[model samples]
Target: MSTEATQPYQRIVQDVRQKIRSGLFTAGAKLPSTRELAETYAVAPGTVQRALTELRTAGLIYSHQGLGSFVTDTASETVGGRTDDWMPDAVRTLQQQVRDLTARIERIEKGGD
Candidate 1:
């Protein structure tokens, strides 16, 4: 996939991290599987795994052999230097959201008599 396509993976990772920190994922909550994640973002499983690996390396997620990955209790504190990893993804996601909302409103207007 092109760089543009992979950008959402980073954004997804960042969004997940936020959820964990906010207790949305909670400690030991089983996150969506790589396949589910890929389906949700229309990306390859490899891309999801790559993004998960970043969370794992940052100590924000833990994976069991046969089970699944989960958010850790102390993930926020441990992510430390990796905090800024989400900036580009967030910015891009924000930009896309604005564009999507704008387009939807435009389409609604265009249907008017």
Candidate 2:
């Protein structure tokens, strides 16, 4: 699919992803309804639905038929049926932060401060 066709949905995905990572949307938090999200983002409901689907696919969130979507607790959820080495965006960002912190600690230990 063309990138342009998916841009709106991708924007929503990034927004929701950042919120989840920053703890603005806590685990099991009910996501704003798709209609609400669409209005907020000024996109069509279908675009918001697509964004939610992407988040679900990445294991960042989930949805029940009658209930709305919710943030997934990475500690408890096995995302996308893979357990060992799947690194989604939020996890990757966290991993990078850890690596940076470790480097900083090493430098301090070496008196590189």
Candidate 3:
């Protein structure tokens, strides 16, 4: 997928992963609904779903059919492994931030904001 297309979902994934690692989102804590997340992130619900899928695949979260997603009990342990292992994810997060900022700047320059 193109970086522009992937950036929104990756941004969600990185934010949630950081919350998990920081213990801000404790085990069993419910996540916001997909619609809520979409609104908050200013992306489509499908984008939020894509982000959730990544988190689930990473073992950081799980969902119930009728219920909302929740942080996995092992979320912190899964994300807080060796310090060296965090470099790639950290780099991706920084890159995402830069992209987001660039987009905002372009919008502002065009008087879209």
Candidate 4:
């Protein structure tokens, strides 16, 4: 997959993760709505959702049914911790590769490739 093709959601994930790690987005901070994030990043809502889903999976954030997503209380701990609780580098790398491949496949299916 081209780097450009995989950039949008991944960029959002990286930026949000950085903010969490830097304490710019403190624990329990409410993230913007999906629509707001989409507008901020100039991407589709689905892309923002994908980035938020990755953050949630990494234990950095959580979402309520209607209240919207917020940084998890343990988010800073998770970001700073290097324990078994945190995902290993290998796992993260593989996950990125999987996302790239999935995007490539989707583009091909849509005849965008």
Among these predictions, the greatest lDDT belongs to 3
Ranking by lDDT: 3, 4, 2, 1
In model 4, how large is the Cα lDDT of residue 62? 70
The residue ranges of model 1 lying beyond 4 angstroms of the native Cα positions read: 1-6, 79-113
Q: What shift in Å separates residue 34 of candidate 1 from its native position after superposition?
A: 0.8
Candidate 4 stretches greater than 4 Å from native: 1-6, 81-113
Model 3: lDDT to the true structure: 0.77
Shift of residue 60 alpha carbon in model 4, Å: 0.4
Provide the overall lDDT of each model, using Cα atoms, as 2-decimal numbers.
0.68, 0.71, 0.77, 0.76
Q: If scored against the real structure, what TM-score would every candidate get?
A: 0.61, 0.62, 0.67, 0.67
Candidate 3 Cα outliers beyond 4 Å, as residue runs: 1-6, 82-113
* Residues 1-113 of candidate 1: C-alpha lDDT, one tens digit per residue: 34466486696787787787666887668899888999988889988988887776555776655567777655665444345455576563454345435544664799932
Give candidate 1's error at residue 58 in angstroms. 0.8
After aligning candidate 3 to the native by TM-score, how far in Å is the CA of 18 from where it should be?
0.7
Q: RMSD of each candidate?
A: 16.8, 14.0, 16.5, 12.9
Q: What TM-score would you give candidate 1 relative to the actual structure? A: 0.61
Candidate 2 regions with alpha-carbon error over 4 angstroms: 1-6, 75-113
Ranking by TM-score: 4, 3, 2, 1
Winner by TM-score between candidate 4 and candidate 1: 4
Candidate number with the higher TM-score (1 or 2): 2
Q: Count residue pairs with overlapping backbones in model 4.
A: 0
